[model samples]
Target: MASSVLPTPLLKDELDIVIPTIRNLDFLEMWRPFFQPYHLIIIQDGDPSKKINVPEGFDYELYNRNDINRILGPKASCISFKDSACRCFGFMVSKKKYIYTIDDDCFVAKDPSGKEINALQQHIKNLLSPSTPYFFNTLYDPYAEGADFVRGYPFSLREGAPTAVSHGLWLNIPDYDAPTQLVKPMERNTRYVDAVLTIPKGTLFPMCGMNLAFDRELIGPAMYFGLMGDGQPIGRYDDMWAGWCTKVICDHLGLGVKTGLPYIWHSKASNPFVNLKKEYKGIFWQEDLIPFFQAVSLPKDCTTVQKCYIELSKQFKEKFGKVDDYFNKLGDAMVTWIEAWDELNPSAAAALPNGPAK
Candidate 1:
């Protein structure tokens, strides 16, 4: 990985941003501003021949399922289940020390005018220094107090509390916690932020792939384990799993994990109304919750990603009752299967083929 310093003068060469996209050409075009000065690796999982409109002077690389399957492995098989293959492509090709992964539907917000580039330059210096590897996650909601959703640090910092940035606040919803506070956004000049919370040494938390950055070295070998057979990719909670894996590796090595600082605006692509309708109609139930439950049952030494699965499972069960009681139960069952697999095969759990340990 090349040493990347934060850019001065707002030129494009300072950072490398990796985006995994499918057919959202307009969204891709809209995000062109964030792709400046950085190498863009667009993983087009569907048609290898499909043309994408890329910005001028941007160095871009395109990859298809065949390429992905070779890099990943059995996990790639999960991509076949989704229309757009999988979301694992971005991590597969990220070669920079500081990699920013954003969704196709989201774009980076531009820094406010009148702020000197020195602020951004200084921010970059802080980011590059060996302080703590901070992961930035965003909360997006138009109805929440202050700015839609909260970003950067958690709402209330309690020990062992799940340090997750809310994706959106579900207002007036019973049985769900409301996100009521907002942290001051880090200098908007940069896309990433240093987190405020802290964890034990070598610990890793599940990072939202939508927009997050950390030293490439800390990510370790879990990327290869996320692959699928047909070269597609896994979907749903893979990012959390990746985070768990990173945590396990770090914990084994005694690295501390922290959260807080720097928040970004995540533009929602799917219609909020339509999604709400689905949720109301029980169409969008979280089926993955089951597998997550099962994942937690694995050995105590299970990967960090597996632990996250368990944590999510507990959250789902505690929040939404039994899966059978709900409209969807398959999601829960899938997580259960993962737990069983890990328990039955401890060796497989310890090391993955093509994963980082090798």
Candidate 2:
């Protein structure tokens, strides 16, 4: 049930909203105004037996655990159930060129001016614009209105790299690590920073999947959330894992990852004790993981995202196998994810861009 009114000239027509949820989607009521027009790909995580209702008028297709098994078949082994990581399944099935993913708990945030912020609108703009990741711009996003690259900024890199990932910020409850959340339970985010900057080349930022958007053709194959520990319900490391791998691949492939701006109101804070237990290993391994990504160097032959990811998986197995047997399995799962991705998206795989993120 779409409105007769045409969408604005923004990147609406080509985009799809992908939400991964276990609970009812009543949170969508607040987003009805902004989300009503776009087609939704709801990846219902957790028990498929449990019914989750969708508000009327939205053009959406809901997929539960049973649907995932039916669609993906044996290749579904690569998909993580009972985890937010399952949202990557929506990315795989999507036929659209652009995808905007938001958490079910996230609500529409207001700017300091009390204006209701349209997060999707800003994400599209970020994706559509060029990102200057190769060189730092002291003046801030030069592509933004009323800003320009300052003196001594290299002219060769000014054209910027094609943005593959657009990472959005959060308001209200900040996305803190388990340790931080455990230490400070009363902390709430109140400041709203209005800026978008490219994650510099060779720099790895912790990517939160909550309010994220990406070009399907460019970096979709590399967007696997993860295949954590043989279907065991793992911790909050899924997006971080994807982010690290995607950043490494993007840096090698000469692409940009942008962040900041288009903040969302993150309402719910999960149990810190639960998060700490799940992310305890993640907290320990994170220190070592950052350096691994920073040191990652892909071969020139690894042109495609799939190839680069496969190489990355090998690196994990080779370097981190002795630390824990899990890396070896995670490495294989990465390859399996690519195989599944190619099986699902044949055309995109066959014609995968080797030159640029476009």
**Best-fitting candidate, measured by lDDT?**
2
What is the Cα-based TM-score of model 1?
Answer: 0.49
lDDT score, candidate 1: 0.41
Off by over 4 Å in 2: 1-9, 356-358
Per-residue CA lDDT of model 1 for 129-156, tens digit only, reads 3322233224322122343323545433
Quote the lDDT for 110 in model 2.
98
lDDT of 2 by residue, 12-71 (tens): 578889999988899999999898888999999888999999988889999998998998
* Residue pairs that clash (backbone atoms under 3 angstroms), model 2: none
Report lDDT (CA) for all predictions.
Answer: 0.41, 0.88
Q: Output the number of the TM-score-best candidate.
A: 2
Q: Provide TM-scores for the models.
A: 0.49, 0.95
